[model samples]
Target: MHTESQLARLHTADLLAQADAHRIAAAAKPPVELRTRVGWTLVELGLRLASAPGPVPATA
Candidate 1:
């Protein structure tokens, strides 16, 4: 009986933890428009960095 109670309590705690984690994740996620803009900005920055010229080698 005590073991069963302990198990139930543990199960409840786990469910509560999962709910909290889901709520936090939902809250932390950016809106679609903001995510899109940030994604595009990162892509543009990556392209610019990729296309940037390297330093010229010094002639001996």
Candidate 2:
């Protein structure tokens, strides 16, 4: 069986690892403003596509 100290150390290590992982993940994501801009741009493009008129007829 493990000692109480060892268990405590293991728990601390696990918490530190989780914190490090979260930090790295947060760094890897785009900034909130940029993400919001891209999201709005995509929505505008989708709206324009949906409202597009049918293709024009070709002259003989």
Candidate 3:
């Protein structure tokens, strides 16, 4: 249970980090092509994180 909680927290942090990165990139006003690439990459990362398997059950 403890390990599962920790994993959850880590996943949450990862998501938050991704969000921050997206926000920073959006605000930087980079070239359209670069911005689009970054945006897609961030979106893909978020999707992968969201779809990732749940934490494994801790062994006794």
Candidate 4:
């Protein structure tokens, strides 16, 4: 059985995953209005890169 903390962590992870998926999808197909906005493409690219799974940060 999972502890309360574990369950909470799992929920948080799931939410993060869903958010990342949305970000990636948005980046893949940005809105026409967004295309006209200055620096919007760069913002989308930044979100895509940030959402990608990578090495965990070193705990101090």
- Give candidates' CA RMSD values in order: 5.3, 6.7, 20.2, 17.4
Q: lDDT per residue, candidate 3, 1-60, as tens digits?
A: 569889999999999999999999899975669788899999999999999998999999
CA deviation > 4 Å runs, candidate 1: 33-60
Q: Which predicted model would earn the best TM-score?
A: 2
- Writing each residue's lDDT as its tens digit, candidate 1 over 6-60 gives 9999999999999999999999987679788999999999999999998989999
lDDT of each: 0.94, 0.96, 0.92, 0.90
Model 2 lDDT-worst window of ten: 29-38
Candidate 1 whole-model C-alpha lDDT, 0 to 1: 0.94
Candidate 3 ranges beyond 4 A from true positions: 30-60
TM for candidate 4 is 0.51
Give lDDT: candidate 4, residue 8.
100
Q: Is candidate 1 or candidate 4 better by TM-score?
A: 4
Candidate 4: segments with Cα more than 4 A from true spot: 33-60
Give the per-residue lDDT of model 2 (tens digit) for 1-60: 999999999999999999999999999987889788999999999999989997989999
Residue 13 in model 3: lDDT:
97
The true-versus-predicted C-alpha distance at residue 55 of model 3, in Å, is: 60
Flag regions of model 2 displaced more than 4 Å: 34-60
Better of 2 and 3 by TM-score: 2
